[model samples]
Target: MPDVLSTWIAQLAAQLGVDPTHVDRTLLLDVARDAAHGVARPAAPLTTFLVGYAAGLRGGGVDAVSSAAAVAQRLAAEQPPKTDDGPSAG
Candidate 1:
């Protein structure tokens, strides 16, 4: 992981009063990748942020994370494939 990302995660974990070991980095990254590929590149971070928010609202825990990730994965799977046609020049 990049130094910046590691630092951010550490800071976020500290602010949330949770152990950094509790954060499932792989699962979160997988969700981000799926969201970006299935939806749009810009959707990755936004989707992950929303998922984390949802998890927090439900009471932060492994279950909350799993539930949020599942929802995100489902939404990504349901997104329509991108098309080759570019936006109108106008």
Candidate 2:
């Protein structure tokens, strides 16, 4: 499952004319992150579709796992600011 995500990233990178070798954690999320644009969670659906599309494009095999891993790593690092970090009532 995770491997599929990576393969999709590779395929997407190729489609976008980005050098796969140059892709890093930040770069992956940069690619995967589509700002709200007046809507929330835009990147989620697109990324999900791309994962499946990439696999279909490559005949149902994992090829972009590394790129997906990079994206996931970037996502974790770029996680939104915590909203629950405040003095707790005890």
Candidate 3:
């Protein structure tokens, strides 16, 4: 993976009080990519932030991360595609 990403994962893991090994990089990246592509590029970081926040609210752990990721994936799938006259264009 890119050095920046690895650094981010390490930092995030440290902040969350978990080992980097416990972080599911693929799952998190997949969710972020889905949010960026399905929703909007600008939504990527916000979506991941919200997912993490939700996970924390649900009691931080593997299960919480999975639950939050699932919710984000579902929302991404349900998002409408962008259009020339879409709200995103305005």
Which wins on TM-score, candidate 2 or candidate 3? 3
Please provide, for model 2 over 1-90, each residue's C-alpha lDDT reduced to its tens digit, 9 standing for 90 to 100: 558767876898899776555545454354455322212346545654564455446553345644454454455355554335422233
lDDT of 3 by residue, 1-90 (tens): 669988988987799687787678889889989988888788889988898889889887789999999999998988777775432542
Summed over model 3, clashes come to 0
What 10-residue stretch in candidate 2 is worst by lDDT? 31-40
TM-score of each: 0.80, 0.29, 0.78
Kindly report the root-mean-square deviation of model 2 from the true structure over all alpha carbons.
12.0
Q: Write the per-residue lDDT of candidate 1 for residues 1-86, one digit (tens) a residue.
A: 55987889899889978888778888999999999888878889999999889999999888899899999999998877766552
- Candidate 1 Cα misplacement greater than 4 A, ranges: 1-8, 85-90
2 versus 3: better lDDT goes to = 3
- Candidate 1 lDDT score at position 6: 80
Model 1: clashing residue pairs? none
Error of 3 at 27 (Å): 0.7
Order the candidates by TM-score, highest first: 1, 3, 2
Give the C-alpha miss distance for residue 70 in model 1, angstroms. 0.5
* lDDT score, candidate 1: 0.86
- Among residues 3 or more apart in sequence or in different chains, the pairs in candidate 3 whose N, CA or C atoms overlap within 3 Å are none
Q: How many residue pairs collide in each prediction? A: 0, 5, 0
